[model samples]
Target: MQHKYLPLIIAAALSAMSAGANASGYRFGSQSVSAQGTADSNAAEANDATTIFYNPAGMSRLDGMQISAGATMVVPHSTFTDSGSTRFTHTPTGGTAASDYVPSQVTAPSFYLSKKLNDKWTVGMGMFVPYGTKITYGNTWTGRYALSDVKLESVTLNPSASFKLNEQHAFGFGIDAEFMKANLGQAVDVPGSVMALAGTPNAAALAKQIAQLGGNPALLGTAKDAHGANDGKDWGWGFNLGYLYTLDQNTRFGLTYRSSISHQLRGSTVWDFSKVTTDPIVNGVLQAASHKANSAALVALRTPETLSANVFHQFDAKWAGMADVTFVRHNRLGDLDIQFPGTAEGAEVIRQQWKNTVRVSLGGNYVYNDNLTLRAGLAYDESPVKNAELTHPALPDSDRMQYSFGANWKLNARSSIDLAYSFLDFKDAQINYTNACNPLATACTGNGETTRGTFKTHLSLIGLAYNYKF
Candidate 1:
């Protein structure tokens, strides 16, 4: 567990670069219980207050005051098998393959309240988790250097208003207040860094120190139980707009747009070397590194914007159908850059270069009786990560299909309950990522170490919501 001099360098790198993307795979898609039942395709048919999050314009079609509260439980599973992974020394970084790095269950919650002021005015507020994810790949995983643990979460509060232009048109706008929290973790290959430091001025001194701790080449791939991590939080602002156009009582269309948000998270670097420190070398290195650093770290982050269109049609007295198409401008997060206030380390970067993405869904509802309705839906989700080489373990995202089912039970004139279940089937994805072993390197997928593998993953969601009308 004792280290020589490289842990200090990796500590600085981890502190500066504290952000990464988890994208569609971990994007907290179950925003509403009602919407989840329809694979989020019922935007034009917003029947409850949750419409405030999807398409506020639909609020114009509601009666009086209404409220909705819900929560969804996400269950995920995954396994990764290594094919060919090598380190900065071009030696095999042999370690255990990962399995179910993400937790078995994660809960996402939402709330909404809407009020109809008059025939032409409607107002509402909504709170929800738009993006969230947490992962732990163990210390000895094949891709430990690239990533071992990652936790990121965001919450949004939206205050919205809508106006009914006439029986045929409505418009809505909302302002968003978002909060973000992030934690990033990885391993610092102590033995492997011996090679990365080959030409550095401190090379000789470092090698002498390592040799004192039994410099063993066999320890190259055998990572110590050492783990490094950093954390930060911030707040950002954005806005959204929606429009609903009614063709007739039985048919309607909806359009919505959400703006992007920019955030700067400021934090100081924190390091824990206890697990890797039985010798005084690690402590000495830390003290020296501390004297030279005079700055806090800052991570710049950008959330993508999105546009969507939807249609709802009534086929008969007992049948209805809906569909939705959405565009996600993920390219806005092409890269994550971090800087130190008073250091020459320049900037550390994780080259995501994510591309834009699209999602499509279709759903249907059957009115079984005066108080019950059954729903079923299907959807396709695309990943913004286009190149396999860019794939990293922090976010095991990929293309997938979603199948959903649910029911709505009207309890009385003023109350109802919604129940839903959904399953995501992801395509087997490949990981061909390379992680830089040092801070001075510059490459989208790293140039020093490569982790090659195939990943299999999937998820399920169960949600429940209660709705009330005044």
Candidate 2:
């Protein structure tokens, strides 16, 4: 049974809450065409099983039974600069420096399915990622002190149903169960006097001081008690709603809305120092206390909501067009609070002035023969990261345009192979980061530098699906 479903798992390899714009907040766009044509319009015409990830109403158009399974390999190559003279330092010497940084390689995966119950109703289920991001800077990086590595992931399970009202209208709804997690750790390299006065007698004390300041184990190498922090596991649920309308024999329109979910992730967090220090006291005493205190500070996070509409038209037997537009509501994530187990310090609050965003797409399909088809599409996606607070490195998003090409090869009456390739071009942008002010010295804290650089990415997809009409 597992072997038979390996493809499904591979196809559903990735479904994060933070992918790009395709997943929930990620990118797992549907791969199905329209009823009257191939998928080439805005997000409105979710006409296939992939619609389980987009909107449920599209299920209403199915006849008896259908199933779809496929996979997507998402590859993104990114670079960053300490642009505004962003500060970073090399160990052993501990001097200020600057250099271009390259992030790690990322691969994302996905899966989907739908079924019809009767003439007036349809039911379906889909597992996909809608939110997740990660960035790992190489060794000898400049911003090593301020940041080094970040990882975030999110997934969703959707069960939906659609009802046909009359000949021209339909409605659909679904329940979303979501899970999310995040991991982060960075090094902070500042001058010695700044540290001496900051209350650390040596590297060991410095590690303790920083941990008290939410600093991770990236700073002091084998001397300080540097350790990583995990946001643990967060679980929550939301809902999806949509509508579809047929204008005539040749045209159809669709609209969908996905509600935002709030997660109060509850899990165990460990702050271990095996990598930070070899000294027993450093590891056994102060380090142990910090870990105990840190675990008590885990809390909640808010995901965003979105809305989209699509229009698809079958101009002729060989020619068809598709277009879609979508909007995201990010204002709901304005503030996040993590309470501490010790009232001596209280809770930590991170503020986010996230703004709404939009995406637009257009596409078309061509049938070359009875068993083969070709597809092409273009989309413009907006960035969700704000310039002011963009340095966490969990994400560095910017506006981009995607050009995609794909083809389908039918093997028999019930099976087919699908392949697609897409290239993303992004505009260059700058990031300026401000660290929390040092209570003792205000000079360097208030005086931070910026770095300038650029980024570009590409994606490849290969999927196989079995379809049986009964």
Candidate 3:
């Protein structure tokens, strides 16, 4: 029965592996093409239904039913160069010869709809991806023992309502239902230390068979180069609150807050020994041992909360300016703990020690004419990970600068098309990681290994959207 579903599982995993996110800390920013053009500073300038994401209270600003749909193409380029790496046995001493470690492109899509329930009320709904990540390294790379691939994907459904106290004040609240999944893969080395136990009681025959199968008898018990995979999925719930204040016809301010969410993911781990050796006798023994080590795991993950303030000012009908300040409580993600049920391995904890971060953006729009609007913006985003030691291959986050430009073309009084482009430059990052072997494991033991390298990344986003008012 499990074999029948193996292919489907693998396919789903691969699909998840191809998704990626934007902004710092795996948060995406292309939910609205209109906002993407202005470097995501549209919270207070709620001119469309997309405000359902940035500030739901802005929904009260819309006069009628509105629908907005868009997609963003995210193109990321990451390169890693080997500084120096050492395996447990100190046999391999450098990183992979291949330079590119991340995929070149991916896409994220979003949809939003808003309706004015009455003169003092508005309702809205939206679907989008808020957090995701994907990274793939050469399978035989020097760091393969530590990590080879990692994927994290999440989607959120939001339903919201806003109440207008008067012409100047509006309050909004919403519920978030989010689904997330994660997959990780790595290689396990077969070390000589394990092979040394060949003459021992339970290992004698297995060791002899491995030696006869062309495996170095000298490295009898070590991880003979097996593969390990972990995959899981979960659902979490949260809420958001927003307030909008219109100082006058020409100026307005918006504040929004999104609550944090916690997820307990259920998953399983599989260790494939067939990849380690080809001998039938040795394969049978190792396969059985690998299956014995397989166990179900429960992992806990938390997404951060965020607070944002936005300002919009209209100097004239032809010129308007906007600014935004956003703070993310990333410190909540202290660590990731995975517990194996019915296994003696107990649990494994990876410390994150992340810090709260802030992002600032400034933008302006120009009414080129009655039918065209041009937008430009600049932003600086901080990373939650403090340094290289805290950085993981799955999310190699860094402080970044963004420059964006966009345009909105009005096809008629009730329809328009939006286009935006953004360029992101991430500061170079350093990685220094080490994994120690477990002496209690009977399969392999040779101390551990260290991987040191430099990572460089940059990304470009192109977004397109169509908006309609009824």
Candidate 4:
């Protein structure tokens, strides 16, 4: 009797909360097309309405009503090569390693609007994607037990207000409302769970059957490899602050801070047991233990906060330069925990132990003519993972460099267009993770499995936007 339904025994590959963002950790990073024209170093420029995201105080500099809309295209490539991966039984996990995981390219969008209520006060709003990702690996990869596929996304809406205290000083505040969703999938070991029942009642017969069937290598885990998947969505809130200081008509400095947001993703877990052995004894025992069709699941997490500083200077009619620095408090993602009800192992944890990080950027602009301007920049971004030991298949992070360039076209006195491009290369890094099953659970099946491998990677971004002054 070949049965096709079974519950989970141990969830080794649980979650990678910070899995698929273009920026370090879970942030999309590129929020504005004009900003990307200078490698994202335009915080003090306040030339467009997008200032609502980077530095709201800059909004006070806008006249009348202004709006900006844009979109970015992100293409990523990820490949994995296994060094030494094994099953819970200490046997080699027989399978082909993944050459590439990210199936294709992705696109993100943004919009901003600002209204100068008076000479001293300005109000604005922004709707943009702050975090998002999409990556998939083959189901039979060497690290199948650790990660099979993952997709995550988030959107934030910000309503801001700014006050011009004087000719040289301005302050801004905003309310941040965000929503996030995620889905993660991985493979399960049914034979491993059966073996966990060894020495118990009616177990001698099952053991003999397993050993006899092992004679044919083709049937090894084919009929016993199950699957586990989880999906959920949630909403969170936070705040932001911005300040702009103008030392003179030719120079300006901007500082901004974003607060952290906490969220509890509520979802459910589904297990597939459609390929279990036909043996009644084998099927009955496995089904009778820790079996459930579905169960409630929850994951508690917090996004990180950031502090950014920037200076923009105009040297001449054809010369301008800017520099920016940002500090990310990624320590907020220390330990990620998940809860699953009606299971032997009711919960699982993936230790991140992430560290704080920094990003630095420099850029320059030149006016080729009255209606055209060219932009270029370079930036260095750091990852939060301390080392390979803490890296996971979900988020194989590393330090990287951003190379960017773009241009601006002023169509007329009230309208303009911006186009930018960037290429990012992450320093090579490794993933070293141990078995994730909690042996202490009553009916666990983890046998000290480990996944150690490296992933292939590539990233590029192209942004386009239109700005209007009404």
Candidate 5:
């Protein structure tokens, strides 16, 4: 597709901003097999057969029919304090707002299942979310022109199989069907006086010219407002490869690789908002112009690739331990492309300068009596987006640590229930931007402003598994 200038500018604006409070954007990946991994020494090592996601090759060690399902609900809070460098001249909500930011809460959900077929093969299917986030700010927010709210969601269906080649080795493979959707909104500055000048068919033309001169502080009288509305949903496919090795009667090792998937989002972009509310603009144009309410834009978002290795060790009769390390090629996130329709010249735009991230987890389980078991785990995940360029509200990202606890209760013989919960703590990070943000501007100035703060999250999970031994 040919690149369009306007759409690229908008796209660049959207990509530079890190999604704020929503997990749909940059939260930690969830675990559905929370029970199996929650148990003993293997607990911190391999955890359940769900290790297929954590370590696919590990599927070779399971016997009989093993099915696992669960979900993680995450709640996040964020705060921002502006630096002296950034300054807002006016706001629709009134006054020169100082120190702008918002806080958010949401639930990120996920689940999975697996079964062994004969002695040589095993088949499994899992349902889970891969990416998403949500961010919202008060109307009077200082950076209103830069951001307001962002929501993104991506889910996946994975079907997998494994083969045991010998007592010491096994291999497995899985294919992923991914579906994703996104919603974005932001505020922009337009001359309040232009509203009166936009009376005739010249509204669209005038709106374009005004947008070009928007960066001029001396010309900026009162802050007139506008919003960006876009939602894109589509599907893509990818694959996972895994291997497992048995070192001894009580020890096992596994590794897995998840390839990256690229998504092209085709959606509508709407620009709507009055030049001013009931409150009159003190200077500049007072008449608001009505332009085409909608436009079209496309976004190509990347899902990073991952490599993980794990070790499981069983000790005595009641305890097991497990540990895992994951490396993700998030550094590829350095920039994202946004495409516009053929009619919209300069179609492609790039945003963000993301870096790579890594994750590490340790867990353990204890067998108490015969029908009940206890589990616990800890993990740390790194962030790809840095502080300075962070813009979008949908993907509020930062490095985080997770502490999880769960258990299984067996009923009769073939039925059982699992319960799990996780606490996530995100390090506080800062954001800085200014009028220079408008890609259409030439001579944009004002110390790009800055905001300081952090975020915290909580997640909960509940599941049921049915077991049948042949």
Candidate 6:
């Protein structure tokens, strides 16, 4: 194969990767241990350096210098049970079985540092992962032609400053430098491709030539699968702002907004046709056809913006309450457009049609004594994915309920340790999608084979942190 054909092969692979899934559009909720303890209602409490992420304005309330470091272990399980799925040719493909497709565990970590520079000003910095996930299915699964493996990872560096404008108000601002990497893999249906190609005028002549070359024409159109993979990385920038108002020393309100960032990912894709057939002529024709359809692809992706508001009230020195409501602009992710520069094929647009979502949380903290504090919280999070038809295997997301509990152990006047645990229960979802085999069809239902199935997921998270002041 010529070197120029390599880009085309890779482009096709990248297209498959772009369709993989992300939970709640790839939002991670474990930015702070204290926040997680209260189901992320700490936006107005701002009791530690982690305010750099929740509500930067809270930094103005900190005295001296403080540092907080933590990590959250996320363990998730997802299983898929097929209902009655088949290949495009209406052949049974064994999609009506049960399998586990999600990774067992992943970790999200965070670190923050804040310094009171003056009587009314504070500065802070943080490092964290806001979006990430991994999903994999068996190679022989019925949906192998649609998806097999996908992984997305990201990290952000944030620097922020807060100003105490008066006794009642404070404001904060920050800049975000984020980096992301993605990988995807899927099986390619070679036999299906050959059958589809048979519609061309030259197919008959090609078949004759293959027969003369001692090739079996019947085998050319038989079911066979290949493999394709792609990986890409990019960097993006955005900003966040926050405001805090104090009704009294015991009561406060907070609001924060994080802007969206856009990325143009650069990557390579590769295809393996070894499993297609051993016939050189057949393989050559397939490779040439694929090369003509592929190109060096550039994919554009965007991270959604977020808005959150919270209230923190101190009932007394020993007891306090907090509540929060957060909005995610997931609708910003409408579709992924993959472009092959200088090619007439234009861009491959994959429809996502995601919807915006919200999260609501309620919690309380009780200071048992100078040495210990206990916390508990509950939350409801909406999924951006609307229905089963649009749900992809890479991200079988659903609405979720989260229950959390935590504690703070005071080591000294200026030091403490925080621990928290949360259980996330996701509603079971059903998927009934088919890869469109007919080019003129408006939906997958009538144009191709259907992969009908059900998905179930559950997640557990444990967080630990050490906080200190100087």
Residue 102 in model 3: shift from native, Å? 2.1
Write the residue-wise lDDT of candidate 1 on 226-281 in tens digits: 45566667788999999999999999999999988777776554445445445545
TM-score of each candidate?
0.88, 0.77, 0.89, 0.89, 0.77, 0.88
Better of 1 and 2 by TM-score: 1
Assess the local accuracy of residue 376 in candidate 4 as a C-alpha lDDT between 0 and 100.
Answer: 95
Off by over 4 Å in 5: 1-27, 33-49, 84-109, 191-223, 275-293, 343-350, 390-393, 434-470
Reference-based lDDT, each prediction: 0.72, 0.53, 0.73, 0.74, 0.53, 0.73
Q: Select the stronger candidate by lDDT from 4 and 6.
A: 4
Please give the range of 10 consecutive residues that has the lowest summed lDDT in model 1: 1-10
Give the per-residue lDDT of model 2 (tens digit) for 1-470.
Answer: 00111111111212221223233223344433221122224344554576766667777877666666655454555455444334321113232342323222344445566778888999888776665555555323544434445455667888889998987998899999987665545442323223333334545565665566665544434343233344456668999998988788778888889987766655443445554444444444444333233443345555667788888787788766788888877556453454444334333333344557787788887778988877778877776556645423333456666677777677787666666666666655445443332212322121122333433333333333444444
**Model 3 lDDT per residue over 1-470, tens place:** 01111111211211121135456676775688999999998789999989999999999999889999999888888777767776655556443554566667778889999999899999999998787667778577767666677766668999999999999999999999988777777665554334434457657766666677665533333346666777777788999999999999999999999998877777787767665554545655665543336777676666778899999999998999999999988787665555666665535434456788899999999999999999999999888777877665556667889899999999999999999999888888777765444323543221255667777888888999999999
- Report the candidate with higher lDDT, 2 versus 3: 3
* Segments in model 1 whose C-alpha atoms lie over 4 Å from true places: 1-26, 195-203, 207-226, 286-295, 436-447
Q: What is the lDDT of candidate 6?
A: 0.73
Ranking by lDDT: 4, 3, 6, 1, 5, 2
Off by over 4 Å in 4: 1-20, 194-202, 205-222, 278-293, 342-344, 436-448
lDDT of 5 by residue, 1-470 (tens): 11111222222212212332212125336545353234211322433456556655566667666665554444444455444322243223232343323323344444545677778888777666666554555445655545456555667788888888998888889998987767666544444234333454554554455556552322333445655556777788899988888888778887789888766667776655544433323122222322223567676656668777777787867987778777777655655555545332233333456666677788877788689887787877776666655533334456766677777777756656666666656665555433332323222211122332233333333333443333
Which tens-of-lDDT digit does each residue in 1-470 have in candidate 4? 00000111011111121223456766788899988888888899888999999999999899999999999888776667789987776667777867557746677899999999998999999999887666576677887777677777778999999999999999999999988777777776555654554566645554455456543323323346666777777888999999999999999999999998877677777766555655544443444443534666766767888999999999999999999999988887765656665554535556677888899999989999989999999889888889777776767778888899999999998999999999888777788777566222444333245788876565878899999999
